[model samples]
Target: MPIVNVQMYSGKNQREKDILAVAIIEDVSKILSVSEEEVMILFTEAPHGK
Candidate 1:
């Protein structure tokens, strides 16, 4: 199992994040020979401090 943590500035919509998460999970699963369920994804959002 692998834990995927994505940290970025808060701006993207939920749909975009969802799509990216799924894409990452699929690629990680395929390359690691693990099931999608075994891959854990966590997204951390922060302000740009602009």
Candidate 2:
């Protein structure tokens, strides 16, 4: 299993997040030789400039 932790400022909307998550999942799974189900993406959002 591969876990990707993304920490970024909190300003993006749901559509952006969804698109990013899907892209990340696809690339990570392909590069890591893991199934999409085994690839995990965790986002930790914070206030801008925080």
Best by TM-score: 1
Total residue pair clashes for candidate 1: 0
Lowest lDDT 10-mer window, candidate 2? 41-50
Model 1 per-residue lDDT tens digits across residues 1-50: 79999999999999999999999999999999999999999999999896
Predicted model with the maximum lDDT: 1
Question: lDDT, candidate 1, residue 1?
Answer: 78
Q: TM-scores of all models?
A: 0.94, 0.90
Q: Give Cα distance to truth, residue 44, candidate 1, Å.
A: 0.3
lDDT of 2 by residue, 1-50 (tens): 89999998999998999899999999999898889999888999999872
RMSD for all candidates, in order, please: 0.7, 1.3
Query: Which parts of model 1 have CA positions greater than 4 angstroms off?
Result: none
Off by over 4 Å in 2: none
Error of 1 at 45 (Å): 0.5
Residue pairs with backbone atoms closer than 3 Å in model 1 (clashes): none
